[model samples]
Target: MTTPAQTPRSQDLDRIESELIAFLEGRTRASWDEDVDLFATGGLSSMFAMELVVHLEQTYGVSIRGGDLKLDNFRTVRTMADLVRKLTADKDTDG
Candidate 1:
């Protein structure tokens, strides 16, 4: 369970999403469209993908593992936001 201090608000989610989008935009030469497929379009590589997971875990204070680390969860910025929300909610409930 998370203490009140550790809980992430909706703004935090938005911030994380913005940071991720900015990071992806800067790292890859391709222009980022929020609806574009990051992997299919060659915007993100396997190495960058792992880096994203690490960033999410650190920034959101959430642990992602097993099925949670699948490509579907990491496919898009919106999906990433949803994954973080689910993980954060699960942690808070468990805590």
Candidate 2:
């Protein structure tokens, strides 16, 4: 069974995927696979990546810094969602 926190986290991930796919679709005029490597596919720009960092930090209320600021972590929408889950859990436990 999903806990209360798990429920919102799952929903947030779905929302994140939706938002990202919408951005990609608007920019590339093509459907995006959830698991496709965004960097490899040239689907993301440096500006967009930074925008994603800001969006994740603000939307998830979790800071992205230090060792967590890795490009590999943002390879795909699913991976970014995973990072959000991890950072959010870390914040919860720390406080």
Candidate 3:
């Protein structure tokens, strides 16, 4: 099942969201939506964001660095998906 408005970017975000939810659920032993704030609920920490950065890099093949290291980017699954999309787009343009 798909929507008529599902662009490639949307599809990518969907995949990212599903994978992120699975990973977070496995780590926290709980389930959440893409918009849920993982940190606000006390289920995650700034330290855990590093592990997330590594996971994003390894899973998406995108190198996160500099300004992109901000904790806000990893606060929610939606934000993380957006970050991956941005990094992936940057990679596409750079190479």
Candidate 4:
């Protein structure tokens, strides 16, 4: 059973994972696990990261700038989901 706090997080993770998988469907052949390192595998390139950043920013309506723009944040599906959640939470708090 999920608590109220855990429910949103789980839903967010599921949504983010689905979106990431959809984006990567044709770009790579390998099936991606949430925690797997996207960079370590040949699944993504530096150039592709920019595209992903754009996708995330546009999709989530979150501005990922400054210190938030780190390669580590985009290293894997789970990390990317966490980054989105953080950015969204920050935006909610600020606005």
Q: Residue 6 in model 2: shift from native, Å?
A: 9.9
> Which of candidates 1 and 4 reaches a greater TM-score?
4
* Predicted structure 3: lDDT: 0.91
Question: Between 2 and 3, whose lDDT is larger?
Answer: 3
lDDT of each: 0.82, 0.84, 0.91, 0.87
For candidate 4, list the clashing residue pairs, or say none: none
Where does candidate 1 stray beyond 4 Å?
1-13
Give the clash total for candidate 4: 0
| Worst ten in a row by lDDT for model 2 | 2-11
lDDT of 1 at 35: 61
Residue 28, model 4: lDDT of 74
- Expressed as tens digits, the lDDT of each residue in 18-83 for candidate 3 is 999999899989888888888898868877778989999999999999999887888899999999
Tell me the TM-score of each prediction against the true structure: 0.77, 0.74, 0.92, 0.86
Encode model 2's per-residue lDDT on 52-92: one tens digit a residue. Answer: 89978987788999888899888998888888888888888
Winner by TM-score: 3
Judged by whole-model lDDT over C-alpha atoms, candidate 4 comes out at 0.87
Ranking of candidates on TM-score, top first: 3, 4, 1, 2
Candidates 3 and 4 compared by TM-score, better number: 3
Better structure of 1 and 2 per lDDT: 2
Candidate 3 positional error at 60, Å: 0.5
Among residues 3 or more apart in sequence or in different chains, the pairs in candidate 3 whose N, CA or C atoms overlap within 3 Å are: none
> Between candidates 1 and 4, which one is better according to lDDT?
4
